[model samples]
Structure formats: C-alpha cells, structure tokens
Target: MATIGRFVVSVVGAGEGHNGRRTAAVARALAFISALIAFAIAGLMIFDAVRVVNEPIEPDQVDFRLVTGVMLVIMAAIVAPLGVLNLIGARLLGRRKPRGRTSVLTGSLLGAVVAFMVGADAPVVVWVSVIVLFIVTAVAAALPGTKRWVRGAPSPSESGELVLGGVG
Candidate 1:
C-alpha cells in the first residue's frame, strides 16, 4: 500500500522544466522591460496630473481636469506597486528563483481591469495593444518551465520513475 501511494504521488505530480534556457531568458527580459515601462508610464501620468492641476483654468474646465487628474492618480496607484512587484520578480528570475507568478497575475488582472475601464475612451489600436501586452506578460509568468523553476522541482520524466520496473 505504501509503495502504491508513493507511485501515485509521483504520477500525479506536475511536470517541470518544460522551458529551455532561451525561453526562460526571454521571459526574464520581457518581465524586466515590462516592469520598467509600467513604472515610467505611471510616473508620466502622475506628472501630467500634477501639471493639469497646477495650470490656471476656468471653473468649468477645472472640473473636467480635476476628474481626469483623479483618474490618472488612481491609475498610478494601481500601476506603481505592480511595477515594483514585476521588478522584484525579474530580479528573482535573474537569480534563477523564478518566483513571480502571483505578482504577474495580480498585475495582469489589474491591467486588464484598467484597460477595460479606460479603453472605451481610447482608440481601438491603443486598447488592443494594452490587452495584448497584459496577456503576453501573464503568459510569460505562467509558463510550465517558469512554474517548475519557481517551485524548484524536477521534471517528471527526469525523476527516474518507471512502471513495474520497466517490465510493464
């Protein structure tokens, strides 16, 4: 019974190391670049908001700018932390840690929500690009090899398990 249980555990375990060195390298690069871009955009939005607020304008225009600035502030709040998390994740990947799935997921979901909320007001191309970027980043973080590396587990085929001692 114990042997059978052990076999079951091994068989049911998830596979690892599906990603080659090149793939992992690409993912790391993408994650890092995405993080930097996110942070930069957030900073720019903050600056724009501040500039809009500081500009002298009529009361009616002020109300519209205030609303836009507030929305930009909210977007920055969502994006800045995500950028930090992605940066940490990228560092971990560089160190062969690969432990950033949660951060990736969170960032992806938040980005999707933000895109959906603001996409209606933006051009179609901009909306599509944002959606695609979010998807690609999320997928890169959840790749099979990435998960295996993050969990520090060996691939199933490399575990040296065989059915019935190679006689089955």
Candidate 2:
C-alpha cells in the first residue's frame, strides 16, 4: 500500500545520509522547475481573467462570463503564491535547511489541485507538463533524506559521532 501511494519511503539501511542529501537535492531542483511552470500558468490565467473582465457585457451570457472570469482570477491568485513559495522553499532547501518543507508541500498540493481542475480546459501539452511537474515535486518531498531533514534529525555526517569518548 505504501509503495502504491508513491510518497511513502520504505527503503531502509545504514548510511542513508548521502542518499538523503542526494534526494533532497533532486527535490530542490524539481521544486524550482515546478515553480517556473506555476508562474507561467499564473500569468496566462491572469491575462485571460483580465480579458474576460474587460469584455463587453452580453445580457444572456453575463453570468457565464462573470463565473469564468472569477474562477480564472482565483486560480491565478492561487498559482502565483504557490510559485513564489516553491521558489523560496527550494532555495532554502538547497541551503540544507528543512524549514521550507511546509511551503513546498503546500505549494505542490495546491498546484496539483489546480492542475486537476484545469486539465480538461488546458492544452494537452500544458496538462501533461503540469502533471509531470506535480509528480516530480511530490517525489522530491517524499524522499527519505528529505523526510529526515524535515523531521529535524541529524544526519550521520552532522552527528559528530566519530570522536572517541567525547574527545577530539
């Protein structure tokens, strides 16, 4: 079941610090990439929203136009912040600080939700890109090293256990 979920880390062994560091690096890279995609999507959506807002009113279609504009605006609003947060979080993660986990997780989850909502309406290429980015972002977050970092555990390299009897 855990394996089916895609995010669960089941691999176990010694010397995971190096593996974790590599995994975190991958996640950071993916987060940065996804952030760029989110920004582009947000910009396009905002443009569409603005166009809808400025379009001439049609008595019969006013409700539909308004609803469409509102939803577009809402999606843009959500996407822009997610992009910004992911960018910042990824930067921090690269610096070996796990504090950005919350931001990364939030942005990824929200982006995934938005992608699902707009998939049918978006172009095939855009839809596929969004899905791929979402999966990559998720995988990064679920990596074993990332989990350990986020949980505030000291990796073996940083644990200073090599000194014998508490002496240098």
Candidate 3:
C-alpha cells in the first residue's frame, strides 16, 4: 500500500517532467523577448529626448520637455500595468504545476485585441505586443513543480478493506 501511494505520486509528477524542461526554456526565452522590447522602447525614448533637447527652441519646433514628459507618462501608464501583470504571471508560473496555457494565451490575446482595437494603434505594435505576451504566458504555464511523492500506509476502510487515501 505504501509503495502504491508513492508510485501514484511519482507517476503524476513525472508525467510532465520531460515536457517541463522544454516548456520552461520556452518561457525564459519569451521573457527575454519581452525584456528586449522594453529595452528598445526605452532606448528610442532616450534618443528622441536627446534630439529634441538639442534642437533650437522655436515656436514650430516640438517642446522637448513636453514631448519627453508625455512619452514618459504614456510609457509609465502602460508599462506599469504590464510589469504588474508580469509579476503576477511569474508568481503563478512559480508554482509547481502551473495551470492551463490556454487561459494565459487567450487572456493575453483578448487584452491586446481589446486594448489596441479601441486605442486604434498601429497594426504591428498591437500584433507584436499581443503575440509576445501570449507566448510568454503560454510558456510560463509549463514550468515544473516538486517531484517528490511522500509514501503513506493505506488506511483500513469501514468495509474492512484497505483504502488508499479515502479512495478505493
């Protein structure tokens, strides 16, 4: 009976072990992509800032401060939320057997679609953003959990038969 309990646990954990490595690697890769995007955005903003600041202040010329400030505000508004979401997702995937990848992918897609659809943003921006988030979320769900299965003795049932954790 004890051997049976241990075996059951081992079976459950090992079932996904092989797949877990590949999936986890994919998640890390997607996360790297997200970081890259964020870096690119930040870099562009910085370049734009320098260009505007060096330009002579003319009425027709764009206000560097205003432009930079607006850019910062927009970046903060959107990136902050994404950062939060990433944190939540990282935490969830931190678990041993993360939930369905479908939910994560569907959610990211729905969010990107609705946000960009209403915002009327560029096609590439919206699509890339959605796809990237989808990939990240999907990969994160395949991370592994604790692989140990504690052995336990079977308990005697009221019917006078050995029962395994309340199951026959």
Candidate 4:
C-alpha cells in the first residue's frame, strides 16, 4: 500500500516532483562522499572510546573513561533536545512551514569538520553524529509548510534560500 502510494506520488511529483528527484540524486552523491567521512571518523572514535574504557590508565594521567563518559553525556544532552525538535519539525512538514533550518545544520557541519580537524581526544563520533543529524535536522525542519521551515514570506517557492527564523 505504501509502495503504491509512493508510486502515485512520484508520478504526480509529490515532494519536489522532478526537482525533488533531482535533489535526491544530488543528495545521494553528496551523501556518498559525506558518509565515508562520517563512517571513518566514527570508526576512529569507536576505537578511541573503546581504548579509553578498557585500557589501563596511569595514576598521574586523567582517566580516559572520565573524559569519554563526560563526552557521551554532554553529547546526549545536546543531541537529545535537538533530536526532539527535529522530530517535531519533521512532523510539521507540509502541514505548516517555518523558516529554514538548513543554515543551522550547515554551520554545525562546518563546525564538525573543524572540530575533527582540531583534535582526536574525547568522543568525536558523538559530535560528528550530531552535526550530520544537524544537517538532516535542518533540512527536515525546513520542509515546505513545516511550522519550523523558514523560506521567508513568499508568494511563491520559486527563488530564495531556505531560511531559519529566530526561534527553532
């Protein structure tokens, strides 16, 4: 049933119509590149995290667990709230629009790149996950007619950057 519906929507140009399909194509291309970086970083972080947890620590050095544990907690705290909001924004897509969230996500993504380049200590995986999700969240949150979507007041969707209003 869902497949049938999707087919119908696809025929009719549901999301972006042909543009959406094209966007998907481009997104996939981008994702192919991004997912590699993401997975590689994640793999490295996992190694670091596991090492921190199981490795013996010197009496003079800070406990890796303490640091990693702190990182996980902090990551959870930050991601959880945004996750909820992103979910809500997702639900609102096509129902009511808000300013675009993509910019926020884009910023976070850039930040993530910088963060990873900056250091390897702590859990980089969590941060990368959040930023990736931030990109997703921002894009999702900007879906047309979503409460959180921000394209600015428009007579039409023809031209303009998706924008994020002041509030999330």
Q: Give the number of the best model, judged by lDDT.
A: 2
Candidate 1 per-residue lDDT, tens place, 65-134, comes to 7887898898888777767877777777665564556666566656666666755766898777776777
TM-score of each: 0.66, 0.68, 0.41, 0.34
Candidate order by TM-score, decreasing, is 2, 1, 3, 4
Name the top TM-score candidate: 2
Instruction: Show how many residue pairs clash in every candidate, following the order shown.
Output: 0, 0, 1, 12
Give lDDT per model, in order.
0.66, 0.74, 0.45, 0.43
- The reply for model 2, stretches above 4 Å from the true place, is 1-19, 56-64, 148-168
Which RMSD does model 1 reach against the true structure?
12.7
Residue 92 in candidate 1, Cα distance off native in Å: 1.2
TM-score of 4: 0.34
Once superposed on the true structure, which residue ranges of model 1 sit more than 4 Å away at CA? 1-19, 59-62, 151-168
List where candidate 4 sits over 4 angstroms from the true fold: 1-62, 97-168
* Candidates 1 and 2 compared by TM-score, better number: 2
Per-residue lDDT of model 3, residues 46-157, tens digit only:
5665665566777985566766656655653554344334434434433322332333333444444434543344477765665556554543543342212111112345
lDDT of model number 3: 0.45
Residue 49, model 2: Cα distance from true site in angstroms: 1.3
